[model samples]
Target: MPAADWRASRLVPRRAAVSRAQVETVAGRALGAFGLVFGAQTVPTAVDQARFMADGSGVAMMAVVYGAIAALAAATFTRVAVRAAALAFAAIYVIALLAWPFLVVDAAGMAGRTPWLYYLCTVATTAAVIALPVAPAAAYTSAVPAIYGVVRLSPSGGGASALIAVLDTMYAVILGIVVLVIITMLRQAAIAVDAAQEAALERYDAVARRHATEIERVKVDALVHDSVLTTLLSAAASRTPAERALAARMAADAVRRLDEAAVEVPGLDDRVALTVLTRRLRGGVAGFSAPFIVRVDGTDGVELPVEAIDALSSAAMQAMVNSVQHADGPIGRVRRELEVRGVGAGGCVIRVIDNGSGFDPAAVPPSRLGLRVSIEERMVNEGGSARVESVPGEGTTVTLAWPAGVEGSGE
Candidate 1:
């Protein structure tokens, strides 16, 4: 890669790393508030005590400015950025002292009393900022030094300020804790919502399955009654060679038409029982379809919400029709291995394996009407998926994963 291109690529990874670190820091800070408060407070104290602040007013003013900058950084903060900014404040405090050597502190004279009002206001502001439910950690960082003073320093006629400082420090801690609680609750709520969404998708797939089955049954019944039997009877009755030949041809055409017409269904929800589904499907096929060797595995006692059940079932029916139409090479084709297994609490997989010419799934975007209506959309709606794998002149496998999670429909 060119120099500029390589530079950009390197920067991208660095930025991503930085972003991830920030997120981790934020999560850690929330869980470890006491540690964060203690660690953050040490910075300002170290700065104030450093030789750079011996000139007093100049260093104090610089600290004030740095504190404001820290507050801004905290207000619009990311996890890593805020921590860096906090340390940056400490670094700035030091740099300001070092860059302007004239303002160096004189320890003996540096013990002058800071205004009581200054500590009170700064501490209160820090508490209020950090107390905001979503406020970042840096908001209250400036108060760390004041908090340290209340607990550490005690005095004579200059002592009332320390008492107020102690109160302020307690408020800051309480405020930070409150924010942490709020964030934790919000996070839990988000997780619940995600679970709910997954559940909804499964239910959707189940419903689709039920409806598809009902429609296919009606079509099968119609085709067998109106077309299949009528043609076969005519073929039998024909006396002449040409009459029998035409009758045989008509019978074949009717059978083909019947298979394609069988996509309609009666309405059903996602909660239909699997045993009931298999029975119903077998009945619809009657004697026209091949005998199915259904070996249900792993469904010891697992079940899913009604909607999810419906979705997977619908996808299964669609896959079956596809097998009948596309998998069979000529007649009496042996497309075996139809299995449904429950995956977990609220998940299952429907797989149909067929020995026939398998087309490139990528080259074909599911041109079959059943594929669009019953498989792809149905699986996705359930937060699951459908995969079709096949090689030319080889077999095809259709797998539909129902999803995982319980919803309002939980048993």
Candidate 2:
């Protein structure tokens, strides 16, 4: 199964799953508001503090530029544009924090009273970037504090003589790392929960399908037994060769029906084109030395799975083979026909008909692979069905139909 399809399965309850979009929305809004307010307040302090420096006007301008950009990014935050928002704000915040080295004067001391604002904005930006996968989020989260630590420890910066600046900034860096790790763990846990939910739903579906199949097998068994008994009685009382032959054919069909009941079928994933399937079916029986004609009706443009097409095509060819080898008579010629047609929405019907000395459908032997394993079982496994329709002296039709998710109907 594709990853996208697995994630999209409706089996997982909506209330039970925690979606990435949901996380992004809540986190983005919270952090966006924080960035706007905090950046607004910090800009004024940063400007005023820069005035005490010998050459601090350029530093003041840098603060205004980055602060404005961060505020704008937060104001325009969107889930779809999360990465862009995160990148824009991260750049501004990290650059602003890096300016701490320049803000630190040999004698004027730290510029902004709230130097911690630069480090805390890193935390806010981390919240906004939670939509990113673990690796990129970790990198973005780490880069912010690491850059702050590097600039703060410079000889000409905050580390000039005070150990307090290094200690204060180190505490903030450690706090940011812890927050990022916790968020990453939570994201991973949510994904695991969703996967488990989907698996449980699939198991429940399988059990239900198995129970339904068991019920269907019981019904098929009863029908096959009754048909077999009736054919046996008819054959015993027959007074002519024609009557015996018809009875024998009916017996063969009954056995085939019994065979169908005994076999287990797996579910089908539809993904093949109906037109392509018919063409393949035609090619499948090309080796037969009998006259065969393939007629397609309606649009053959419908697409289903390749397995589905194979099952239908294989069943059709088996029907044709059965007719050539069993339906032929001394006077009758084999006339095999493969017909493919579209049914309802995303549905298909394939009929393998033959004009020959047809037998009674009730008399098919249990050991006959043609109708049982080759046709009916094949169709059933593909979430489709096959039924044999025949009379004593007319013809036989093996009808196969796949109607999307509906259980196959075969007799």
Candidate 3:
């Protein structure tokens, strides 16, 4: 894809799909709220019946049962157990609504004194609508009221007339339908917002990675110009066999540096023994004209991520190469050392030390890729660090350490 098209595609926002469980939770909460309100409205009727009854109980007990169901639905919506419990409570609600007349005394005389009890059908239907599938919700919401209306509006029944009973029942049914529609829309909206946020984050990450890659490419080009290209030109201009030989070595060193750059620290999860890393470092410097000694401490049973190994080994080799090419003392007399130390905390420390004339590290220009890109940047990229210490007439020590242990080592 073209850059502009790719950018637009990634940046464009879209709606996310809502999960069934979330919809169920929202529906459960809404139904639970309605049930609580309906139950509260029945309180006065419950108190009145309790006062008049010989045992001070009857319809009032039924109100308590309904309230308990509402509370249980509300509480379990956030729990995993709600799936089964919610359906069970909804079944009890539908049965109670259908059996309303049988459960109460003076059903006809009670009349409008308990309008809220009729509305409880709305509460139960809405709960079912939230917790149950479409087919079952439609069946229960429509069936319970259809049965109640028949029993309520019959000629023998002394409650409300047909028109009034139908209107009252319609009030609950229509409200339930409206609430269901609103819940559906809200659930869809929630999903859309979530999708948009995720897309935005992914796009931001992709852009960041592209920018970093471009910057590194420029740095590598500068490195080649300063090191490899310079050595090649010097080789072409040499006047003597000795000068040509030295230039050839420099050009070969430059080529090797480029090749080494291709060997990056493996992913944070890969493991390599410390002994293996030390061997690799020695192998990289085998062509050095000077004496190079490698010392190991605490390498037993120590393993690190591949990336950590790559960074430390490459940096150490670079330090040794610098000693071979620039150290002012006699090649036979000077002692160059590379030490690998492992911390019990799964950390590794590598130091390259040499007793030869050294230049101030600060004097190295920004254009020098050997120290900046090869040593420091490589280490820093892998959660490790490299520090160079040197002064006039004193040898240099390049220290590389990963204090956080190997990446993804579970340390």
Task: Give each model's whole-structure lDDT.
Answer: 0.50, 0.59, 0.63
Candidate scoring better on lDDT of 2 and 3: 3
Q: State the lDDT of candidate 1 residue by residue for 139-225, as single tens digits.
A: 444344444444334331123455665665565456545654654465556445434533443454455456666766777887788
Model 1 regions lying over 4 Å from their true place: 1-53, 56-152, 155-165, 198-222, 229-250, 258-411
Per-prediction RMSD in angstroms? 20.2, 20.9, 22.5
* Candidate 2 local lDDT, 180-244, one digit each (tens): 77666665664565455435434543454465568667787677568878888888998899998
TM-score of each: 0.34, 0.48, 0.52
Q: Which 10 consecutive residues of model 1 have the lowest summed lDDT?
A: 7-16
Rank by lDDT, descending?
3, 2, 1
Candidate 1 residue 108 C-alpha distance from true site, Å: 11
Best by lDDT: 3
Report how far off residue 223 is in candidate 1 (Å).
Answer: 3.0
Model 3 agreement with the true structure over 47-159: per-residue lDDT tens digits? 55433333423555565557566655555443334446556666776565555555455554455444334646676677666667666777777776766676566422236
